[model samples]
Target chain A: MLSRNQIKYIQSLHQKKYRQQHGAFLVEGAKSVQEVFQSDFQIEMLVATEAFYKENTRLTDRQRTPVEIASVADLERIGTLESNNAALAVVRTKENLPLLAGPDEIALILDDIRDPGNLGTILRIADWYGVRKILCSETTADVYNPKVISASKGSFTRVNWWYGDVAQFLSQLGDGVAVYGAFLNGEDVHTLPFGTSGYLVMGNESNGIGPAVEPFVIKRVTIPSYGGAESLNVGIATAVLLDNWRRTGNLT
Target chain B: MLSRNQIKYIQSLHQKKYRQQHGAFLVEGAKSVQEVFQSDFQIEMLVATEAFYKENTRLTDRQRTPVEIASVADLERIGTLESNNAALAVVRTKENLPLLAGPDEIALILDDIRDPGNLGTILRIADWYGVRKILCSETTADVYNPKVISASKGSFTRVNWWYGDVAQFLSQLGDGVAVYGAFLNGEDVHTLPFGTSGYLVMGNESNGIGPAVEPFVIKRVTIPSYGGAESLNVGIATAVLLDNWRRTGNLT
Candidate 1:
């Protein structure tokens, strides 16, 4: 049984402010909830169906995660997902600690990717390519947004992201590291000499990279087009560029 | 001004049934509306704000696309987008024509892509890579779906897709053409000897290539993963695989 106040608290985490205030965020759906349990992130609590609780007894026991048995209706009402069969978790949010582009590491820099679904998909892409650290601009969607978490499909557990002023971060690195930014007309990605490691910057959906971050880009890279799309989705572009990097870098 | 019945008729196009009944679908927002005017498809009518009408007079006149000036509220109400400021159109739906895999053209096969957004993104991805034709499984989301049209970001204008039983289509090709299917364990995409022209089949989001379509695939291709992510989003995977195909096929 879920208390009204408890439901209200969980529901509040839907918004960024409430999440910040509570120092927690939601990981909904059975897969995400299960991923949260296995992640390093602290599980504050779980509202789960009895079946889910019973099936994952060892995992719950291992984490010592406090769970309240709830109905599907309770889960659906309190969670952001339209239909959550199994569980919803309240997990602790990670600190916005600074991240660096390690030597021989292909890092990702997201420049104000506003859509949460796109952000989540990018996380999964980053995870697939083994791009360990991501530097997200302040205007980027909140990584903890439920939509982002749900769309990540458990990749959030493996890939780490740091949110901060990307321009300032890029300025800090200066000419010491190569920064490759995706542009409409630039070096053909097919032939670009991608080094062993660099920072790949993807910009906002409508606008390309912000002016502040533009100067830091050592080389503007573009995937040559054969057809008539005005632009590729940010997530798709990221995967294409990263795949090229991995292929050239022999990291694959 | 939009009549209540006119509004009702336009709103009905938001569903597959009404779209089929009327033999037309919707193209919404300024960009898509603009693209539709420039495309080869027949335009049934347009509902635009005074601003949109006066601005794109040439475009609306180019196709002799009949226009009825309306308020932004009318566009928002009749269309699927939450915020559509400029215009929307009731455009003629293309026939379910049989598309053949051309000798030197890269083609896409969608095996039950369900998400309208994913299907839309794939269309955009296909457009970016210059894939001219796509064969969608009947279970795939309707090409005329407003969400698909919206998410496609106007790429629908350039990409030609045929919807029907994909298994029958694949069965028709049987060993005469190279069919590459995305799989968990298969040939490495990086080193795979990809020909200039072939069919790349992307499977359902969750189930992967259906059993019916599996036997028809000549080669199972896989994108090697370096990180902990379980799988790539179908759109991202399609982009990655398409990029490699273009590169290897010398179609770049």
Candidate 2:
């Protein structure tokens, strides 16, 4: 059962301003909640339905902090979902980290990705491809946005995201770290050196990579399209690039 | 202005039963309505905000039949979106066609894809890749679901989809046509023959390819992971496979 203030607090997180003020955000649904629990992020509060508590006793036993058991109806009242899952949790904001380019690791650099779902999906893609570090333009949607969090589907835990000016970060990268950008016309991904350790950068859905960071790209890669459609979704393009990169053993 | 009955009729198309009964579906938003307007699909009616109708004479000029013009307020009352777009249209459903598979063509076969967004995103991917045909199990989400339509962002006009048993369809295909299924432990996608014309079969988000269709696959492909996560979104996997297939010169 939640008090009026509690409900208001949870609902306030829907907006970025309130989330920033509270220094926390909400994660809903069973799978995401479970993933958050397993992650290092501090779980400020664990709100769960009685049924979820009973079924996930093993998960609860691992909690360093006690979980707050509540009714399904209680969770539903405070949730944004049409049908709230068995659990929801309030997670503290992770510390912001400086964007770091690697000479050996394959990294993903996102330039001005605006959509929350696209950003989240990209994070999940990064997680799947085992690219842990994601450098984002400050204009990119907040990773804690519920839409982004929900779309990431638990991959947020594995991927480290850093928000910074993409242009400045790219210029500072050291030697042997190839910077790859996706463009309409670029070298065929199949022919590019997929085995080398590099930074793969994806751009905005409507606009490709902005001019601010374009000059720093060592190589531009294009996903060859056979159809008449103008472009692929940013998230889809990122996945395609990552898959091709991983496939050819190009990124060391 | 829209009559009460006309508004009710437009709203009824939201339901699958009514959409099927009338053999028409709603295509809203300016770009989608305009795209279908130019396509082969017959336009049943057009409703637009006064500002839109006056400004965009081209779409109205292209209409073979007299288009119904409704006021913004009236359109808003019957619209599905929070803030209605400039225009909306009712389009006749294209006749359901048998799935077409042939030599030297890339195809995508979906097994139990449930999410409207994922299905819609996949359809757009197919359209962008110039994959003309999409085969789906009967359990897949209806293409006309508003969420699916919105997610596809108007690619449905170009992509052809057929619903049937996935296993039966795969079994009937000749040995010369390669059948590739994406899995975690499958052969590395980079080493597989990608450029050749073939069918890429993707499965449900959680469970993956069902057992019934498992044995029919001639090649198993995987998006090799560098991270700790278990899988990529099924839609993302499709884009990855299609892009790699094109990049490898297999499709060209």
Candidate 3:
């Protein structure tokens, strides 16, 4: 049973303002909550149904955070996911640590990716491809958005994301880092020669890479389109590009 | 200006039952409406703002469909999209034609893809890779769903989808066609050889390829994961597999 204040507080984390103000965000549904419990992030609260609490005796026994046994209805009322019957956790948002890419590491640079779902999916894709760090433009969607957390499917725990001015970050990387941007008429990604380490820049959903960040891009890569669609979804494009990069031995 | 009955009818199409009953679905927003207007699919009715009507004189003049000039507010009120300001069109759903695969075409077979957005993104990816036909399990999300239409970004016009029992259809296809299904522990896709013509089976979001359809899959293929993610999004998986197929000269 959740108190009225607890319900309201959980609901408030749905918005970015409250998330930032409280330095906390929500991880809902069984998979995400379980992953968060095993992660290094600090958990402030855990709300779960009796069935879920009973099923995971290890988790319930070793609980370092406050656990509130609630009904599914209570969990749904306080959570963002429509079908979250298992668990919800309030997790402290981690600070953006300085990410220094090594000479043989591939990092992602996102420019104004507005959709939370897309951002989350990209995080999962980055994690799948062993890309540990993502540099986002300040205008990109909040990494802590509930929608993003839901879409990331627990891979968010392993990936680190930092938001800043994308162009400034790329420009200041100096001469050693290679930068590749996805474009419509760019060189075919399959045929393009990729260095072992670089930053692959992906642009907005509607607009490709923004002009301000174009100068920082040393090479423009494209996924060849054979049919009538205008463009692939941003997340899909990123996954395909990363697959090719990894397959062609571009990532160490 | 939309009549009250027209508005109600448009709103009814939001539900799958009504769309099936009416034999029509909506194409909302500027990009989708424009694309549907140019497609071979017959448009039953088009509602648009005066600005939209005036700008596309060719479409307005050669319109065989009924045109009703409507306000942007009306479009937003009756449409599924939250921010459609330009146009909406009622398009007749096309009949599912018998798809015959030549020796040079690669097609997609989807098993219970429940998310409309994923289905739509799959259609766009299929269109991009020149896969013109898709076979879906009867339990797949309706292709005519407004959410699916919105996510397809006009590629819905180019792709043809058919829904039936996936196993039954594959069983009937006999030994002439190669069937590849994505599995977690399957053969690595990059190292696998794909023929020019075959069926690529994609499965459900949470549950992968169902057991009922598993026997029909002759080849199990998987994208190798280098990082910690357990799986990929269904739509992203489809795009990556298709990219690999096309790049390896498996598609003519």
Candidate 4:
């Protein structure tokens, strides 16, 4: 049975302030809960339906922390999802990593990407492309948004994210590293000479790269479109751009 | 003013059966409404706030049919959106295209794509890539889903979609066309030599290419992942594959 106060506390985590105060966030759904449980993040509590306990024995057996079996109604009461099912786990937030850049690593820098789903999908792309770090402007969506977490599917565990003023960070990086931006008209992505170590910048959905970040870019790259789309979705464009860079740069 | 009957009529379009029975569908928001007005599709009704009419003279000016200006609250009453937007236009349903394929054109065939957003985004991609037609299995999400209409943005105006059994269609196509399925362990996308004409089959989000569609594929293509992401979002993956094929295939 879930106490009213417990339910209130769980609901509060939906807000960033409450998450910051408690240093934890909710991970719901059986797959997401399992992923969080297996990750290095610290788990605060695990609540599940009786059926969930019986079905997810592997998840329960592997828990190094305390686990609780609750009724479906209790799980539903605390779950952020519209249709509550299997489980919900409260896990401590991952520590914020200091911004780090090396001379020979491919990186992604997001400039005020406001959509949490797009951000999460980008993180998943970065993970797939083997990008170790994604640097975002402070204005970007919170990486912990439940929508972002759900969209990421599990790639958050492998990709490190750091937030700062991207313009300042790019300016400070040494001369050998390349900075690429996706522009409407630029070098054809197929023909661009992508080096192994560089930063690819994707801007806000509506506006392209902001003026502040524009000055630091070494080359503007674009995927040539033959059709009528005004713009590709930020997430889809990210994947296309990254796939090309890795393929042409032979980063893999 | 929207009567109770009128509001119910608009809301019922949310269902596929109602949309089909009425031979029309709702298109929402300023951009989408403007696109439909500019297209050849017949507009059955136009519902908008006074401010929307003031701001978008182009929408009101382009109308060859009767236009209805309702209060924002009236628009809200008949609108399907959560926040309630400025305009909603009901477009006469597009005529089903004849089931025909050219010997040399790229076509996307969705097996069981359930997400409206993915389907809409894919339609936008097809439009952007100059893919003129998309064939959907009857099991795929209805193209008129509000989420689909929103995600497709304005591309639905240009691309043609047909519904049929994807497996049967693939089996009937001659050897000149390359029927490709996106699979996990298939040939690396970068290494594959692709052709201009054929069916590009994308499968269910979680299960991937269905068993029925799998047997009909003459070739299997895979986007090589360099990192730990188990899979890409179906929509993003579709763009990457389509983009690569257009860039490297005989189409170029």
Candidate 5:
């Protein structure tokens, strides 16, 4: 059972301002909440249906986190997801760790990916491709948004993400670190020689790479389109590029 | 100006039963509405702000469709999209054209892709990759769903989609036409040789290729995952497989 104030507090985390103010955000749905529960992220509150609570008795018993048994109506009232009848959790947002791209690792640099779903899907893609870190422009969608967390399908627990000025971050990279920027008229990615470690910069959904980060791109690569569609979705484009990198790059 | 009856009617089309009864589905937002306006699909009604109406003078003048000047509030009230301030069109869903897999063309076969957004994104990917036709399971998300139309980003206009039994359709395909189905433990796609034209089967989001359609697949291919992530989204997997086909297949 949730009190009025508890429900209000959970609802407030839906907004970015409130999430930042409270230093927490929502991880909604059964799959995401279950994944976060097993992850290292600290949980503040776990609101779940009787079924979910009963299914995970061991974790619920071990954790000192406050657990609230919620009805489907209560979850719909406080949670962000439309079909969240299972569970919702309030998780403490971790501080962005000071991390740098390693010499032999691939990282994704997102330049103003605005859609929360796209951002989340990209994180899942990164996790699938073994790309550890994602550097995002400050303009990118909030990682802690409920939509992002839900769309990520639990991969959010593995991928480390940080947001900063894309240009400044790219400039600070080690000398000779190849920066592959996705472009409309670049070298064919199928044939391009990709280094083992590099930052693959993907741009805004509508606009390609912005002018600010374009100069830092040492190599430009493009996925050759065979059809008449103007562009691929940014998330789809990222997965294709990452697949090519794994296939042809030194990392393989 | 939109009448209260017209508003209620438009809102009703949001449901599958009403859309079938009315034989129309909404194409919302300026980009999608503009694309559908120019497509072969007949438009029953064009609901637009004065701004959109004034800008698209040629389309409005030529078409016999009823034009309703609607406030942003009316569009928001009736449309499925949260940010549909520009335009919405009531488009008559076209009859499924009888299509067959050509000897020199690739096609996508979706097996119960349940998410409207995934179905829409797959359509866009198909359009981009030049895959002209898609054969979907009868259980697949409705192509005429407003969410599918919105997520397709106007690519729905180009891709031809059909719904039917997966096994029956595959059994009827011409001999020597390869069928590439995405699987977890299939051949590594990087080294796999692909034919010019074939059916690429993508399965449901969670369950993957259904058991009913598994027997019809000639070749099983998978995007080799380098990370610890469990699986790629069905939509992302489709793009990667299409990318590989374009690169290695005889089509290119």
Candidate 6:
């Protein structure tokens, strides 16, 4: 049985302030909790239903993390997902170290993306396309948000993210590294001469790339629209752009 | 001011049974309500704040749509959106008649896409890529669901959809029209020889193309994964596939 204090503490982690103060975040639902064990993040504890605990005892023991068997109701009460019958985990937040493009690697830059679901979907998309590092603008939705984690479908474990000033990061990029930004009026992504390695930046949902970051973009690319859609969703735009990037043999 | 009976009537349309019985659905939020006026849909009634009504008097007058001046609170209570400060409209749902591809026109087939948001997002993506007609399986989420309408961000105004047995529809497809189905193990979408005009079939969110619909696929396509991520969201996959289709000069 979870003590009231324990349940309150877990619930507190749902907000940014408590999460930052405790240096921990939540991984909820069956798939995400299972995958978090495969990640390098430090696990603080796990709360799971008896059925889930019995099924995953070996995985739980292998991680050497404390596990508390609880009812599905308990799990739902402490987590963000509408229906979580499996488990929830409290994981230590990783240090926000700097990440750069390795040779022949494409790094993603997210500029002021405010939606947690969009952020999570992008993480999954980036992971599918082999983008290991994501540079997020500080204004972007918190990577640790449960909504983002839930939407990521456990991809948060595989992708590394760093939050900072994206404009500064772009300005300091090494010579010969190109920067591709998605824009309404830009070079058609299908025909653009993508470099061997660079950064592809996506902008906010309502606005394109902010002025602070626009100047540093070496080339602007567009997934040419053929119909009446005013804009594509940011996550959808990211997948299409990354797909074209990999399709052009830019992926290593 | 909305009558108590009228407010209760709008709230009833939130459910599938009521929506079908009433033969009407809601279009909420500033953008969607504004765009619905441009669509061919019959406007039953529009509820708007006094400010919105004053600013859009010409537009409200153009369609001869009945208008009810309401507060934001009334709109929030009557609509599904958490925050709809501007307007909401009661739109007549279209007939689910048959829709087939035109010459050199691409059609979309959705097999059991269950998520309302995913269905709605797919509509927006299809609009962006110029895919006009969408054929949905009977099990797919209703296109008129408010969540779908809200997530579609006004694209429902442009795209046409038909609901029926997709398997039967595909089987009865005219000769020589190719049907491309997305699969994890299939021809790489990047290099697939897309036909001039055909159907791109997207499967359910979790199960992928249903067994009933799978046999109708003339060719299977995949957005090749380069990383450890297992799958892409259905909407993301749709965008990538359509992007490749358009990139290959198949969009006429």
- Note the clash tally of each candidate: 0, 14, 0, 0, 0, 0
List iRMS (one decimal) for every candidate: 0.7, 1.4, 0.6, 0.7, 0.8, 0.6
> Per-residue lDDT of A156-184 in model 6, one digit per residue for the tens?
99999999999998888777888999999
Candidate maximizing DockQ: 1
Candidate 3 lDDT, A83-183, residue by residue in tens: 87899999999997767677878999999999999999999999999999999999999999999999899999999988888888887887867899999
- Tell me the tens digit of each residue's lDDT in model 4 across B10-86: 88888889999999898988888888877878888878877777787765677655567887677666767765567
DockQ of each: 0.91, 0.72, 0.88, 0.86, 0.78, 0.88
- The C-alpha TM-scores of every prediction are 0.97, 0.91, 0.95, 0.94, 0.91, 0.97
Per-residue alpha-carbon lDDT of candidate 1 for residues B31-65, written as tens digits (9 for 90 to 100) = 99999898898998999999999999988998877
**TM-score of structure candidate 5:** 0.91
How high is the CA lDDT of each candidate model? 0.90, 0.82, 0.89, 0.84, 0.89, 0.92
For each candidate, report what fraction of the true interface contacts it reproduces: 0.99, 0.84, 0.94, 0.88, 0.85, 0.88
Two-way TM-score contest, 2 vs 3, winner:
3
Clashing pairs in 3: none
lDDT of 3: 0.89
Q: Tens digit of lDDT per residue, candidate 1, span A129-184?
A: 99989999989999999999998999999888898899888888856698999999
Per-residue lDDT tens digits for candidate 2, residues B1-252, read 677898899999888889889998888877777777767888888888777777777766676545667766666667675566488888888787777666778888898899988998988888888898999898888888777776788788888888888899888878777888988889876656674677888998889888998999888888777776667888888888777677666534
lDDT per residue for candidate 5 within B1-252, as digits (tens), equals 788898898999999999989888999999998888778889989999999999997976677788988889888988988887799998898786657878779989999999999999999999989999999999999999998998899999999988889779888877777888999999999888888887999999989989999989999998898886898988899999999898886324
CA lDDT, candidate 3, residue B248: 80
DockQ class, candidate 5: medium
Candidate 2 runs further than 4 Å off: A1-8, A54-63, A174-177, A250-252, B54-56, B250-252
- For A110-171, candidate 5 gives per-residue lDDT tens digits of 99999999999998999999998999998999999999998899999999988888899888
The A-chain TM-scores of all the candidates are 0.97, 0.94, 0.96, 0.92, 0.97, 0.98
RMSD of each: 1.6, 2.6, 2.0, 2.2, 2.6, 1.6
Candidate 3 segments whose C-alpha is farther than 4 A from its true place: A1-5, A60-63, A250-252, B250-252
Model 1's CAPRI class is: high
